[model samples]
Target: MPPNPTSYDTASEMAGGPGTLEGMKRLWTPAWIARHVAMVVLVVGFLCLGWWQVTRAASGNTLSFGYAIEWPVFAGFVVFVWWREVRHTLRGTRTERPTPAPSATAGSEPAAATAGVRRPVRVSRVPVPGDGVQDGDLAEYNRYLSWLNANPDAKPGDYPG
Candidate 1:
């Protein structure tokens, strides 16, 4: 049964007009098509990897048995994320990331709730002091060098503690 035109439906009102298949055609754009093709290829590649791992496990290579189950799971996760993105894009809403709802830490904001643009992550590889090349051993090494500098008669193997 058709509803009366005066019915209050806030979502449809905000949608601006009847959501139709016209915008859904954007799903077939070249970039999206390529993404779909890549998704298919990734699934095939994962299946091949999983099969190879399974064959290895059958031949007494126990390590590959775990990997045999891993590849297909990765493929499934990729498809899930892709499906969500397609649905989100076709909704005709602003693609900017929605602000996270206020939490118990109410005043704090999420770091990168931008216009759907993600910031690149920076990875630092500096060695901390105490672990091998970090602090304590480095000081000990420096002390050994200084001790060698002072004790000219010491043999090269005679490192100071």
Candidate 2:
């Protein structure tokens, strides 16, 4: 069964399918009309610029040849972006969401400090014999790290070698 037109999830669907005359009419809204006008102006402006570059190139400014090609490519990019935005507007899908502010309490730690923060986990490693590293050196390094972790305020030079 065909879905009821009025029961659509988006404004575009409510007007009609995207390619239909009715749907196109929806694009005539003030904001969309402004966008349409802007796109037209940009495309025309770019083409004119390209044409100017082409004339300059013909007059023997070699650099203008590259500019002539670039301006037209810029026009194509503007059209592509405009088309993408139009499609997204028609789909009525939002790309971003508002983030909630962190809450604070009297005599409590700041939310920023606790939120999304993880404490590092200590892993114990068993020394493999004949791994080219002396086991005694590995054990001494592990002991040094443990001492550093335990005495957060102590300077490295304070550790007895």
Model 2, span 1-161: residue lDDT tens? 87786875464344455655665666789998999899999999999999999999999999999999999999999999999988866555333445876777889876655467877898879745585766798789989999999999999988876
TM-score of each: 0.46, 0.47
Q: Model 2, poorest ten-residue lDDT window?
A: 89-98
Best by the lDDT measure = 2
Please report, as a residue range, the 10-residue window in candidate 1 with the lowest summed lDDT. Answer: 12-21
Return the lDDT, model 2, position 116: 78
Task: Write one digit per residue (lDDT tens) for candidate 1, span 32-119.
Answer: 9999999999989998999999999999999999999999899888889888888777665523456675454667756544569988
* lDDT on C-alpha atoms for all candidate structures: 0.77, 0.81
